[model samples]
Target chain A: MAKRAAFDIPDGAYVNLGIGIPELVAKYVPEGREVVYHTENGLLGMGPSPADGEGDPELINAGKRQITAVPGASYFHHADSFVMIRGGHIDICVLGAMQVSETGDLANWSTGSPDAIPAVGGAMDLVAGANAIRVVTQHCTRDGQPKLVEACSYPLTGAGVVKRVYTDLAVVDISGDGFQLVELAPGIDFEHVRDLTAAELRPLPN
Target chain B: MIDKELPTAAEAVADVFDGATVMIGGFGEAGSPIELIHALIDQGASGLTVVNNNAGSGEVGLAALLKSGRVSKLICSYPRTAGSRVFPDLYRSGRIELELVPQGTLSERIRAGGAGIPAFFTPTAVGTPLQDGKETRTFDGRDYVMEHGLTADFALVKCSRADRHGNLVYNKTARNFGPVMATAATTTIVQASEIVDIGVLDPEAVVTPGIFVSRVVGVAEPALESELVARGVSYP
Candidate 1:
């Protein structure tokens, strides 16, 4: 799913990847394209994880994992770093989602369970501020429940913010009408993908 | 002599009073002033309101401070992180109150507080649960939620280098929230790895100017929170 999402990113995009599968998109950006990675914790031109013994605790990503900086990387304070986000300077933001509504609403931050500790982080800012927002996730939950739904039951991170979704079954675009199929993963049929989606899935256009 | 330098972390935080709103700068453990926080822990001030990006990881640094039960309220973006049991436990038990702000909004609030802006409108959390009960207005047909500037009684920050005058330079991504938090606090205390001479630091490269900072403590070799947590070390 990550590799498929990477294929859609235009060259020279300033991209912010949310933790989890979205983080892997940087590694598969088709070699020739130069996409600068932005970590909302205040590093631009972020590099991959450092060697086992060379990790610096202070030089880490948004996920709080040790990461290296590219040679041209620049560090700024949180305000300026977020300016790149809230000011809409970020070209693309790919995030992991718990649920996405047919209207492009994103619900990745909270499950709304009273027992769960609600943590928002930068997910709302990324969805609202980035020029384009994409989500990469599994088509269904581990228990086989569809994540693409008519309406999000969880607390939303942002409303009507997602542009596209890359899942294990298909690549779907959130349009004014609803979920429009962009492309299917190899050998995945339209009916099979639609069966797993609680929302209406429009087949690919001719 | 314009010496803002202090000899110990305990001395730096000695004057912090109970019920003070303090901003502890860091995104996770990076740029976290652990020594200052530890000192604050030992200082034993209670009913404190603490601000940071994350609550803290493991039973060290901010987590350790939270575990000590000194902080009564936390203002932050994300509190549930890997190995972050302290804040969650306190929050669930209704011992600690949490004001969960979105990351960018939190940063802007600190920046605005420092810059003397009382309140600002942002489009970040509009139409979400975070926008509930906040003042909302539309400008140019786009909706926004109003957020107030957040100031603090004190700010605890960590930096890579500092001068006697309190000018600071941070290392890598560890610079998060330190500069803005320094400005947002009445007394911004800093812990630096090296305290250099004034003018030794390039004027153009200084991340935080001296006027915002109140005191500086030198921790030539600061303890890494990850290692401390790895060793199962908890604070006193």
Candidate 2:
């Protein structure tokens, strides 16, 4: 799913990858593509993790993990860092999703459980401000429930904000009409993907 | 003489009273001022309203401050993180109150507070549970929720370098909430790894000007929160 999402990123795009599977997109951005990674905690041109025992306690990513700065990296404060996000300067944002509605609403932040500690972080801002939003996740939950549904059961992070979704079983786009199947994963039939989706799965255009 | 330097961390935070609103700068532990936090803990002020991006990771820094039960309310973006049990436990037990804001909104609120803006409208959190009970207005046919500016009585931040006048330079991504929080607070206290003489730091490279800062304390060998958590060290 990460590789498939990476394929869609245009060269030289300034991208923000949400923590979890989305973070893996950085490693698969096809060779020769010069993408600048943005970590919302205040660094652009974010580099990979430093060598073992060489990490600086102060230089880390939004996930609070030690990271290195690329040669041309630039640092700013939180306000400026968020301006790049909320000002529509960021080109792409790949995020993990808990549920996606047929109309492109994203619900990745909270489960809304009575006892759960609700933490939204930057998910809302990314969805609201990024030029394009992509989600990468499993097609279904561990309990065999569909994550793609007619309406999100969980609380939404943003409304009608997602553009496309890359799942382990297939690639889908959130069209004006609804879920449009773009491609099926190898060995997985369209019927199989459709069976797992709780919403209408429009077949690829001929 | 524009000397903002203070002799010790404890002294820097000595005047913090109970029920004060304080903002501690950090995104996790990267920009966390452990020494100042430790001092705040020792100073024994209670009923603080604290703000930060995340609840502290382990039993150190912000977590230690939370564990001390000094903070009664927390205004932050995310509080649940790996190795973070302090805030969640307190929250679940109905001990600590939390006002969860979106990260960008939180940053903007602080910035607005510093810039003297009372309130602003943003598209973030619209059509979500977070937007519930908030005022909404339509602009260009798009709805935006209103968020009030946030200010604090004190701000605790960590920086890489500082001058006698309190101009600061931070280390990489650790510069997170420091600059903005410094502006939004009445008395911004900073812990610097190195305090240089006046006119030594380049004027152009300073990230935070002295006007926002009230006191600067030198913590040449600041303790790493990750190391402390790794060692299972708990604060006194």
TM-score to true structure, per model? 0.99, 0.99
Fnat for each model = 0.97, 0.91
Tens digits of per-residue lDDT, candidate 1, A1-206, equal: 99999998889999999999999998899978988999999999999999989988899999988999998889999999999999999999999999999999999988899999989999999998999999999999999999999999999999999999999999999999899999999999999999999999999878
Candidate 2: stretches off by over 4 Å: none
Chain A TM-score relative to the true structure, per candidate: 0.98, 0.99
Ten-residue region with minimum lDDT total, candidate 1 chain A: A26-35
Clashes of 2: 0
Error of 1 at B182 (Å): 0.4
What DockQ does candidate 2 have relative to the true complex? 0.91
Candidate 2: tens digits of C-alpha lDDT, residues B1-236 = 78899999999999999999999998888889999999999999999999999889788889999999999999999998887789889999999999999999999999999999999999999999999999999999999999999999999999999998999999988899999999999999999999999988999999999999999999999998888999999987
Interface RMSD of each: 0.6, 0.6
Give the Cα error of residue B43 in candidate 2, in Å: 0.9
